[model samples]
Target: MKITRKDFLRLSGLSFLAGGAMEAARAIAGRSSAATESQSTPVAQSVRWGMVVDLRRCQKEKGCTACTDACDAAHNVPRLADPQHQVNWIWTQPYETVFPFIQNGYAEQSDAGIPVPLLCNHCASPPCVHVCPTQATWKRADGIVMMDWHRCIGCRYCMAACPYGSRSFNWVDPRPAIAHINPDFPTRSKGVVEKCNFCEERLANGLKPSCVDACPQKALVFGNLADPNSEPRQLLRQRFAVQREPELGTGPSVYYLV
Candidate 1:
């Protein structure tokens, strides 16, 4: 059997779990988990960050890539020419693909072809975090699912655990592929996983997510979902919204207002 490059990389990632490195990785994960719990406070747990995408508004501008472009620029996400190695923080999926449960005939005709932006849902119970043996991916106190690139073992367990297909593996060194690097953000090396973090770095600086900020239609709304007065919460109350695979019980924080 001829092993492809991708298969070789996958095998290498699995082989990395052997020997002294695996034990050291486990030790680091244990210590980090302990510190995370000890550092959590009431204020940190009070705010739950969420995003609401108004599909009605978003579809008005057909083929617009502003949100995705802004996200890539801000995060330094590589723009690899090959589809196999493309790295994206935010991108679009056909409406039908996003909501397979919606089988109404009229609804399908009207909305099925629309391009709905997709990203990590930042679930209340993130399977990616739970499956990461290195503690590389963990849910933050504020409900953000974070990736600690340094501790990532590239085992791809988190990728398998995420049903949304939100995670991307660094099949090669990503820096060189980036058209223009964003110095504010760090780049990833080969053998690591990456994904949208809800722009936690920007949030810490008191700014909205780059994607939300760049949406010309003002389709993306971000705020603390715990606050009833927040735009996302208010929208959820007034409009009909649905999450990606809500039945899976992951408690996705990203909602789409239909």
Candidate 2:
């Protein structure tokens, strides 16, 4: 339950506006939680972290769980045999179900039943943030929608607000279900709604998100969208990419190159 120096520095800066965050961090640490280290300072407009999924490369081979397994193991996501209690940070789903709008005649013309990876989009203006009465789920300086677990009351409001159905709530003690215990990150208890945070702690630690690093196919691309020279931005300029549901105008950071 050792708190990283990065988290110490982050709490030090936040001491002014929110003394509660410090106390919460202490409580989380006591629970053997991985405290999310915040940005040293407010991120400027030039830093908008985003990701790209090259669907062309994401096709799963037999017995392959490279990206999903790595992400869950790193984050301590649990596996529940109960279908109703299943929790997924990042996982593959049928293409038609993922992109329901492209249905019937539209979907049949394309990939059809192919499985596609999905996760939280970490939108530019996340509806979850707007609906959170406790402000538990809030966007960080770098275009990331992060959750303050301590502040989360487990009300599931964020889950209701998210149009993408990206959020998952804990129905039981999620810790016991974790097969691989990577102490680098903390595990969640029952009742809190959780989802992909875009691995903000890894970003602060000068590392890529576990999922991105673990991908065998190099299908996930993460970078600052504001940087025109970045790989994600460069790809966006050259290749055609589409959001999950652009009509909602959530301004999702993640794009899929189908």
**Candidate 2's residue-wise lDDT over 17-133, tens digit each?**
487877788876864332233423345577889999988887655345788888898888999989789888998788887777767675475687777878999998789987888
Question: Which candidate number maximizes lDDT?
Answer: 1
Q: What is the lDDT of candidate 2?
A: 0.84
In angstroms, how far off is 234's CA in candidate 1? Answer: 0.5
Tens-digit lDDT string for candidate 1 (1-258): 999999999988888767568898988899879866744545536699999999999998989999999999988898887888877789998988878888676778777789989999999888998788877998887889999999999999999999999999988888888889888889888899999999999999999999999999999999999898999999999999999998888999999998
Error of 2 at 131 (Å): 0.4
Instruction: Please give the distance, in angstroms, between residue 242's alpha carbon in candidate 1 and its true position after superposition.
Output: 0.5
**Candidate 1 versus the native: TM-score?**
0.84
lDDT of each: 0.90, 0.84
**Model 2 alpha-carbon miss at residue 246, Å:** 0.9
